[model samples]
Target chain A: MTKTSVNLENPQGYPEVPPKTDSVSPIVSRVREVLRRHKFAYLSVGTYIASMVVFGLIVFAKGSNPFSVFAVVVQSTMFNGGSIEQIVLRTVPISLAALAVAVPARAGLVNVGGEGQLIMGAIGAAGVGLAVGASVPGPLTWVLMALAGGIAGAVWAGIPVLMRTATGASEAVTTLLMNFVANDIMLYLIYQPWRDRFSSGQPQSQPLSQSAQLPSLFGSQLNLGVVVALALVIATWYLLKRSHWGFALKVVGGNQEAARRAGLPISRLLISSMLVGGALAGLGGMLNFAGLEIQLVPGITATFGYIAFLASWLGRHDPYKVLIAASLFSAIALSSNGIQLNFGLNGSIVDILLALIVIAPLFLSKNRKALTK
Target chain B: MNGIEQTLIGGIAGGTAIVIPALGELTSELSGIVNLGTEGCMLAGALGAYAVTVATGSAEIGIAGGAVAGAIFGLLHAYLTVYRKADQLTSGLVIWFLALGVTGVLGTGYVNDAITPLPIVSVPGLSQVPWLGPILFRQDLLVYVGYFLVALIIFVLHRSRIGLLLRATGERPEVVSVAGIHPNVIQVVAVTVGALLAGIGGAQLSVGYVGTWFDDMTSGYGFVAVAVVLFASWRPLRVMVGAYVFGVALSAESVLQTNGIAINQYLLDALPYLVTLIALVVVSRRGGRKAPEALSRALTDVT
Candidate 1:
């Protein structure tokens, strides 16, 4: 047994050689290191192109010219005036939704409840808007509606926070489940007491008064909500990059035990980060409702929360990048309508494209250590 | 039969659909790979099976196609997580989004189509028994297969050497590797098999229960199966019971509505999710010592 025993460490029974360092030039190694460092960037671009090609192939398979689909999507989403306004309107909510995920992510928490929080925010805004739209001055009503929406989002987000702090449950699952609950709650409200009496058949609340509606900007279809979203993005960037609370959140996210040892209030930070995230999403919901919807209706959020989650991930949680990613997603979403109208393709084709963009980079790059973090 | 009896029977059938996926999830989790994309796999399976059934006019072939579709997605997940070392949760979510989009696009054609659903086969004399007969004996072939499969899983998990090795691989992959086996292979197999079961569950939902296909028809049952696995504490018998409990909760609204009970439909729709949350809270508070050590580490941020 001793004679036949194999050394696992050197199973091949080959002598070790060390000549690689001398053969390879220092400049070459330096170049290699730089390439490796920028590998993810290259992979991201490659994946994006690959995803577009795949989408083109899918369109081609469906018997429509791939070039036409691309042309239609871009022309409809960007070139057309009405569609451009639609894209901007859509971007506002999506940007906020992305911010909602980005904030909590800075605290190392995955808040998938943005959808629920967004819904709650819409409900809160609508509740406030309806109650005071007829009585209070328009400006005050809008302010109150925004505040109520923010508070509702915070409260909705706060439930999972409390659950996480009290019991070590996964916020991902809880938040996902809570979205359904929020939808139900909204459904109950719209169907029962909030039903518009004059509307007859549709399940929706009455339209907000003219004063309650968000004013258009510069005589265009664009509204004040886009400005609000941009301001919030800048504020989020400042908070994440330059504030004591943000620094504490980064510390907490990096290492919870280290933060605790450093005397940071871990629970409070977690709760507050989530609350802020919820508030941002809520604000987005309010802006969306007030600016575009002008009334509470079923599917008001319309998966903006989920799309925002994707945008945040694509942006790597950076506020500026999230804004860009949100805009890109909005373009894709808006273009889906054009593809459906022109090529008879389903609107969900955009989902496949988005999923491919996210997944294809994994296939291109070997370094996955970034994902675990 | 009375409304109570009808409700009970319907609950059993509903529960059976959930149980198949829950069992599959339990298997995957036991191997330390949490596939959150079970819902996606189920959707793919539902569409795949429905399509095949429509094309070939054979329910069995449709079921097989569904399992194959699930296995393909499972392989994708395994490649991303086990080979590429991508984050399991993120990979699962990506796979889900992929399935959702693909199915939504392809399944639009089949939305209005119908197929001959799997017929219920009652046991000869036992099906005639007063109360328990219809609930237990009169069920589709898949339900009976599920029962046998559960029993087989219990045996394999508790009584077989392979089962012990699988459990060991999940708990301590390093140890398994040292003992001359690749743990990754085991993990991949477990996940693929688990996804296969989830797909079958989806097939059951479309063919055995609904008899029709729709876009995203599995809804959140795959996620519910994840919760059900937790609710069962990774035990086979408990998984069966938990699935039925969820099934009952799901069917309660329709049963009440059918019986002329005026309830807010949305509230009933929300019950299963609420129950899942409550169950998760209660179970977590009680401490999850029964969870595989490596799986707990995989899921939670706590070191």
Candidate 2:
């Protein structure tokens, strides 16, 4: 009995390993494990709450009802019918942009040029829609405009890809730099002689014909673009999960060396990834112009490409998840009006909050063991 | 006196905005990380300084506040990219978006009113010196600091022991770690310094060049800085030359416009951007012949 005393430590000066115990249900345990593993997830969600509370407190300090303000945020975004429509309308481009990014992200590529590409695409679509407002039939005109926009976006993105492949340039720099080029080009269009003749001195483009506009989904401002967005999501989900080309894309993403070894066309995949991504963004531009404003404005995109990047990241490039993330972002943008009315906060704060929510996950995962490896 | 001089002057002023962010980015890249958030940091610095200037009426305080704001953004970027190992591109883009959105909101109050800009301080005989005088000496104090910073950066990057360590870390962190130094610590410092410079640069734009701050005032100067870094080939002297060259191109549009010349103002405004793009193509086309060996991995990988 004395010799049978339990050993607290092994001879190696480490604690004795315990024997396996009863396992929790796989499904339930997995859910708990994921939540536990990703502390950043909780932290990010908490950041959303904390930012609101802090903003509310500041509002109160400035002489307002913090509670009522908070209530309004929830009510406008979540419960109101008109507000919900506005949110959905905002989600259209963002979701498309997310898909644009996610399509390439699956191949382990970063597409920082979404902002530029989206704008270029919008400009392209607007150009076609504006130029051919009454010449072509409505449906044919819409298709042509969408295709033109997508092609322009692809071409814009193609320059960086070609450079990266041909000269070993960093796409990050090139893509970013291209953004300015695209912006300047757009500015030149809006400000120079190409400026809409109707606006005496202002810098804006002519509005598209009423027939060029995408029909509303119902009585709301939401248009056929939402349907297109949903369709793309479903198509993407299927392609990624079930198609061979998607498999090839995943392989390319997993490891370039391995993909090369397996005789996969790495260069083709790289260029195509960027092309498709750009095309999607361009399609988003068409939707935006056709469904929402029916015109091109200087700040029309309003950084939707970036918000899409966040959505893609939050969704981890999964189509279903992208849908959810896009919807959430749209809600945030919609609630911005409420936030402004009640708290005197500008709508841009919505972007700030969205960004914080998007990136805050990093802080909470600082000590993760897997990250160390 | 002519279009050339006007373009040259305008370019010099606008180019100042690109310098700090480029320097900061150069610092980060040299220390083994690429900050995508330079755009955001620049915006934060610009807006922060503007907010401070309006509230405090001190350009120095505004610049300082801008630096602080930039440093905070840098720290956040470092913690995410370095510590948590979050996707560098992801964190950077997020930061950029956050800055754009947040700063846009905070910047609304100052949109209508104009703040007093920094007065020019000439350096005596240097200010009177012919072509060089107007080009180099007839600007605010920040302009002089820009040149001094370039020289200092060159000196520090080449002559100091820490510089060697930093360069080595940028090339290969594993090698640096084997030598028993903390790569993360060095990277954090590099990022912070880079961000600080960027903030100062941004402040110069709103306070030194222009008399007031407006939303989106940066107009992608931060992005131009990235191109500048590439154009410079990671060398300080070359960066100075490149920055000035970009500056000249920017000023060209204004000079042309002011002269009553029949030119497309938009096309002129687009020149710097187009030139930068062409420069990038030309530089990149030079291939492995000119690129820093360490950058090979970064160029191919998305992150």
Candidate 3:
């Protein structure tokens, strides 16, 4: 493909030159073309920088030196040992959540139900653990919990997929509303039948047995969830970029009519993609539950699903890129504690930064397009 | 006087909280732009209104401030979604995040303070009636404002030339452009106006209802408002009914609690959202024939 394309003149209306006195080398011209194609990337980076300056001004308005806040943020999030581990732990759920969105996004479907799916997954895993933690072997119990979590997530996501396919309802709104429902269901369970009997006061589920908990990594605060998340990321990257099913799903996403014409099972592909995305999110929930919480409680996901949605968009729905974006966002989120402690600022200040990061590119790219025109 | 009567009155008041935003969303949807950021706008409006009302000791000024704050965010939304051609849902979500953060930061001071709430106006003659009087005649000023706004919206939507243009733009922008009106301008105006109303709704929630400031206080009213528009099938009068129904569902928790019913508070809290999801499915299954053509295309057509 490259060899065939290399000999073809740039179709963007660049002037043809005589071969005799060509001033630009072919390699340089190719490099320039690549750069031009990625102009939006450059603009997005510029916007990120501009947003940071605006955030600094906001800090100033709060009566603190922006530099000091930044120093504290960076020192705590990046330079510290415990904070780095915290970011890694946080990244596990966030990256998986991003993948949950990214996988379905490749098929031109927006699966915003990651939050619901994650919660359901956690509930599913917890249910399994509670039912057989004492009777089943440790490794078998863990395996069953993971499978239940994945299946639960898939089924949770499957509801919206079916709604979209059968009735043409907007999955975006339905998935979002389902998040609240999932939260309520989780709350009901913890507050009632699943409530830890021995523990008084706060409403929480009984703790998972030792067999149900995930093993930590290298004696660090980080758990094996990171390994699971990274493995899923690599597998997703392969499936999206190389697999035949991935190609078919992309075709379906690109044009349903064309895919139908090509004899692809459109509904099957759509449902499968959504299910895979949901399962990934569910697994993230299971990982979070098994690795960190060890008990079902409210706020277990901590809005990781929403943050992951932002990360997916920032990464342009690429699995590898989403991994990087999710890590960056998780770091910033982990550092918000320091910002709150040092500057007396609300921890939600990180949300403002995240919002700006998402929006700046839109405005900048628009300006660039107008300028180019 | 009784549980049923009290619940009915509370329902009307709670329903009004959603009505303003739902109305705003209807207008926005009619113009082919869906601003999910209505939630964010409402949050900002609530904080802005509460802060100003606390400062000046005037609820009216606070309401106006809320509208202004909402309009500002609406302008940002319009600029991004309209001019920049960003994804409407994503842009709306980002706007919401921004509002949540900004309000959370600025509203900390006002959390402990309270402002004088808008007084309920009772018509001397009409309010004397037993069953309907307290529920309808005796209410806050915003309820009356909502009534007038609904009537105005219905008339304008059905009878006016601008309304024709708005509907046409949502159905087919190319045709509207061919007819010499810029669709983008109409969209911007529609979204901003919608946000302004949503802000007012937020103001109503804080000043007229809660009479205090809080961070992220709009909850999911903005999203529920969006659902209400869909449930109403984008009609003005139906939006009123939908809002009232949701209000009844929302107020049920307190009413039941007051009556000593043994129900989980969290389940009650989840009722409105559950209803919304069910309503969406039911409505869609019945065929969403009333949805704008262009808006549907905007949601489904990727590329």
Candidate 4:
């Protein structure tokens, strides 16, 4: 279809010539737009910086020298072995979930059910691990468990897509509702069938065999999952930039009507996006389970999946950008632990501090001024 | 059966969580802006009020604090959804993540007490009457207000001029624009008002019902509110009915567990959602009646 026309010439009931204004050079104008958008991104970065400054002030208020606290936060998160391990462990899930969400986002579908999908995948993989942890060899058990996790996560996500395609229901509501459903399923598995026979009444599963565990790649709480996450990031970047399927997904994501008119199968594309996204999220869950926790319990996801959603947005849906954003958030998350230990800070303050990072960008965009009445 | 009475009581008590948010969501949906951030808004309000009440020892102030927090969330949402022309769904999801993360961090400083919620105010003569009296009149003040809000919303939506205009904005915003009313202003008002009510609903949970706020106290109440809105077909009064149904199911599961019944608590907890899913299927089969035509369109378009 042609672009809709506007009656731009009509002014005060008379045709008028367009008024000329001071114009920037084309290169300069393009540079300004780039700078303006980057300004928004930096606005977000500033909040991250501001939060650290605020944390320092809070430490000063509590009678500690601000410099010492800053040094402690920096040194612990950046140089301390244990803190670095925490950052590495945290990065795997955040990066994987961000990619999980970004892929579907690139395809124009929203998967708020990432938390649920991750939980379901964990449950799926945990069930597989527990059932076969005793008999299967190490490598095959890990692969099969990861596959089970991916399949379970995909199926959990598929429910919403199916409902959307079949009944024209909004996926936002359905996928969100499905989070509770997946959580309940996880609860049931842990509390009932999967409850470790030797455990006292806590809602947890039996420990997997040593063979079911992922091998540590760095021997510093960093596991082979980090390798897998980095590899996936590179693979995802290539697939989106070079693959035909990725191109189709992006087309359908950006505009379904346009994609449909161009002979793309919208339904198939939507479903495939959900599957891939769900699989990535599930893989994140599998990594969390095998690489870090090694057990399924209530609050198993620890809301990390949701944090990853923010990281994905911060990255603007670019896998490479996602890596940087994830690492930044990982640092911020590490600082929370340091702040708690050194300054007796409350843990939840991390969220309040992070809010600044999430919110400042909206105000910083040049378009923001133009959009508001 | 006596079993049904217990379920109804539990449902009404439990369903209060859904009523306010769903009603507020209906307003937003009516104005053609889907506030997917409702859950986050509610959670923030709940946590904010809970912490404030415990710290200050005043429920009213706590409730107001929740409202303020919720309004701030609404303002952010308006800025992104209306001003920036970002995808409403994405912006909402972002707000939710930010809220969840921030609440988790800030809540560490808060040491909350077990809430002694507002007592149920039984209307004297009405509460003295038989079953209906005890069931309806002998309820918490918020429950009564919830019903009243439903009636008020129904009247506002169908009869009032502002309501008509709001409906028009949702259904055919272009028509409203042709009449010289800015659709964005209408949407902002709708979302703000809706968020305010949702905030109250969450506050009611902290200071009026459950009497305590834990991390993530909302437990997907906002998500259920969406389902309630759809189940009610976006009507104010019907949403109350839907909320009551869901409330009853949720309450019944807990009661069953308390009574040591052999029924699976897991299955029971899943019941309300399963029913909601089924209701969604049925609603879709019938086709949504007179919904906002431009509900899912980009906010820049008046229609």
Candidate 5:
């Protein structure tokens, strides 16, 4: 008879006994195995904790009670229903803007011009709304503003896209450069041509007519933007992960030479990806403009493009994950207002927290494996 | 004398800030690291220098403070990208955001502070020489140092063993390792030193140029420096030329404003970025600079 060896995790007729797993309990070992498999979840939690601790130190250094600061942050953002509404409202634009980054990323492009594209979208929407919003029916006004916004965003993204494909200029740099140009253009408009003469204080455009505002959800504080955002999230998930075009984009992004050899329209696919991203960002602008701030103003984005860019990275470019990340970031951002009110801390402290959260993941995991691959 | 001579003088002085940072970025890129945080490093330097100057009443010491601040940032970048193997661009952007926030938080007390600007000096003989004299000779102390640095960097990069190793590391780290040198160590040194220079540049901007502290006072000069490095083809002398071109543009803004010209200040603010975008496209199309092989890998799109 052959010699038989006994297994440690389980043994014949000994299923009830704990394995020789370092003399640990069977349930404990099983839980350890699950934790090992889901290291990313732990990594994110660890990073979040580390960031909050660092932020607490900052608050403490400023002579505020760190615990109270944290409590205020949590209470102001999480406990109240009104804050949740603001977070969800903020998520609408952020999620759409994140999709802007996510889509182009699929085609092997970094669309750092989200800020510019979003601003252009807002400008387009404002132009259309101010021009024809009152003359047209409300529904038609919405349609026209959205189209203008989307087309403008596409045009903005198209500039760097054209430069990249035609001249090999790095889109990362070019797109970033465009943000300054877009900002200046907006400033020029508001400071002069588009200035609302009837208003005082900070310069802003004329407010959209009441009819042009986003319709409320059954007389609730919520508007149609969140619903639209959700629909787009699902739609983008389908198109990017399920369709042949999406498959082509993957091939192009993964290996350009392979895409070329496979007869994929590499340039078209790349361009289309970026254009759709720009359009989505523009649509985000329209939603925000109609849904909340009814007028074009400086600081309109509140760095939405940048925060959304970070959110895209946090989500690893998955549209569904991006939405969640967007919501989370929105909560973090809106907390700044409360923090400032409560502690008199500078508003930019939120940037430090966001930076810390984004940076922690950079080094915590297996080096290259943790990149946005 | 008209504003033309004054503009030329201002151009050389203002250009010094940009040329210094561009040289720093060139050094970093030659080591296979594209630090997008050069912007943040400059901000760190600007605030550090300004704060130090306010405390000690010494612009010279403040510039040193700036260099130290920049080095700290550089060290963080080196650790993240070189040691931890984090994506270079991501590490860079995060550092920049951190710098932006930190400076904003710390720079509050110095917003209204003032200092004695770097004194303008002239070489007596050079000052006597026609059109070039007043234009070139009459510049702040940092401008002269900037000239020396440009010449020194050109010699070091093209002719020195260290630069050869740096270029080798950027092109092929495997080869660098085979040659019995630690490539990452060299890269760390190069990046840190590069960042130190950028800090000095920021110090020049605040203590040497404007003599006052303000939020984002460096504006986007650091970014322009990065662009300048690219169009300069990583050449030190061309970096000066590129920087001076921007300096002229910036000084032109001031000159036009002082003359009561009607161009919108906001539109004028956009000029540098627009020009950078246009120049980048033009230079890239012409193949004016060859990017390091490693840099191309660093910038590869990730999803």
Candidate 6:
């Protein structure tokens, strides 16, 4: 049997005292407590430093100058104009994907299906846009695709939420399982049903018509999805921090039994949180497709959803902070290209850096129910 | 061989890989630590086995290397969850990422390298048996070990005092602690042993089954093993059955492709996970109260 109740032990991410160490500067520790609002920033910076050190050792072991390679990574990722645009473009999907995780997390649910949700969103968007054809106006196509993607994402996410509500299945496991299924679903479509007529060998869906594409911004590499992502971030902040629904969800998350006794509609809050999360992820997938990728391609999601999962945890499930975490992760993920071309390392080595950063904060966090329920 | 023959022949060996890990997972889950990073352990083991086998000419030693490699990942997970009290699912997922990256970087040079696979040996007397002989007796040393391990785990987990201690830890650690036995020690040991076997499973895939090392090559087998443990309801025998079921799903994908059938390979690739999802739902709906009492209460608890 799985968890009888939603196992939400730690809502405040890493709310533990820093492990006492000579390296933990007194000033930093004081700042973490004084500027509680900026604690995530400090946590990120700390994680970044720790990851760099570990990454340096790895590079050194590989017979490379860690300092020089890191210099290249930072310079290429932050200073180069084209690189900056790519990072921003990457952030569009990542931020929305992180929001996909963050929203559900606010209700004490872990929505690890962001990757699957995003893929479904892309498939939904592509299917709708292709069917709408070039006859439809550009703005109309966008709305229709967004709706299709959002609904597809919501439905995908809803399946797991339903399973969790009905049977105490852990959302974490079910959602992760759904991701692979979603990818296969996409592969099946592109392989036969949605196979592009013009493309050969590499199976892909038909490219969206020119009118269906999201417009690029100011002749740069980025698209108008940036604005959409930003607006959603602000909206999430308001909803999570200010709204009645948000309060109800929090009540449910904080104490399910208490919320139920209070007649706050516990199951409704859980389902609504997950639905919003899934819809955002779907929107992310659609935006990524229409904005950057011209057509459905293999590995298109490219671990964007996974990184966004880490980003949400990094942000402690707050919308504004998630935006920052997404941006940081976007930079790190984009730096993979630089590392790949220079160090001749596999592109996936970046996951080590990201994983290190994410896990570092766990050492300090105190889960009140860590050893007890 | 006919298509059905090929699936059975292929599935038994493939099933060895999953069942090994599933058995290991059963041990840890019984001790109350649900290590989702079993996938990471398998990946690490696959690479470790391959690299060691390449460096040394012994597949036997490679299997040991694989066990050690997997155990390290398991140990890390144990530390994070058991001592650090980090969230188990998150920690498990992060461990997978860490293993994926580490293996990807380390296995880069071995991508094109190859090793001589473990030769299959059939039991002389058993080989002549009507049907069960070929499917059960004809396999590599690792497959034989898997068979032995299953019987060993089932017997030890049920009949031994240690098994009772382990099961007791999962049920209520506080009560176990009251009996003067530290539950954390037992949990650490159980999780490590589970990972050790999972690593051997990876070695079985690389050295005994596939004979090649590739990045993320275990695919979803590691995860499937985790799901198998869940649906198997922590029963060792049922876990083995579940593993074989997924094993056939994997084999059918290849068998259909080889038979010139036009079914979508990707769709076939998804069947195991879909089945796993459905199994979790269906089993849970049936009052799935077979988990350790403590574990079922706090899903993320490692204590």
TM-score of chain B of each: 0.96, 0.94, 0.97, 0.92, 0.96, 0.96
Tens digits of per-residue lDDT for model 6, A35-91 = 676655566577668877998899889887888778878988999778988998899
* TM-score for each model: 0.91, 0.89, 0.92, 0.86, 0.92, 0.91
Which candidate number would show the highest lDDT if scored against the true structure? 3
What are the per-residue Cα lDDT tens digits for candidate 3 across A280-322? 9999899989888899988888778888888897788999999
lDDT of 1: 0.85
lDDT per residue for candidate 1 within A310-342, as digits (tens), equals: 788778889999999899888888888888988
DockQ of 6: 0.49
| True lDDT of residue B226, candidate 4 | 77
True contacts kept of each: 0.58, 0.78, 0.59, 0.42, 0.60, 0.62
Candidate 4 docks at the CAPRI level of acceptable
Off by over 4 Å in 4: A1-73, A197-202, A365-373, B48-65, B101-115, B171-181, B298-303
Which scores better on lDDT, 3 or 4? 3
> Per-residue alpha-carbon lDDT of model 1 for B1-303, expressed as tens digits?
787777778778888888888888888989888888898999988988899999999888899988898888988987887777665666777888889888888888999887998899999999999799988899887788788879989999999977887899779888888768899998899999999998898998888877899877887889888877876688899889888888888888788888888888888889988988898888778875567877766665311
lDDT winner, 3 or 5: 3
Please give, for residues B85-112, the per-residue lDDT of candidate 5 as tens digits: 7767667777777888788777877888
Q: Candidate 1, what DockQ?
A: 0.43
Lowest lDDT sum, 10 consecutive residues, model 5 chain A, at A364-373
Indicate the docking level reached by candidate 2.
Answer: medium
lDDT of 4 by residue, A257-339 (tens): 89989999989888888888888888888888887888888888767766777788778888999888888777777787777
lDDT per residue (tens digit) for residues A1-373 in model 2: 3685545656456665789865887898888889888865576678667766666665565466878866887898889877778888878788877887888777766777777887888888888888888887888888888899889888887888888777757776777777777777887777764567777655687788888888887677678888987887788788778998788999998898899999999889878888888888777777887888776677777777778887887887888998899889878777788888767876776776677677655554454435455
TM-score of chain B of 5: 0.96
Interface RMSD of structure candidate 3 (Å)? 1.6
* Candidate with the larger lDDT of 2 and 3: 3
For A56-93, candidate 5 gives per-residue lDDT tens digits of: 89878888999997788789999977898899999988
Looking at model 5, give its docking quality level: medium
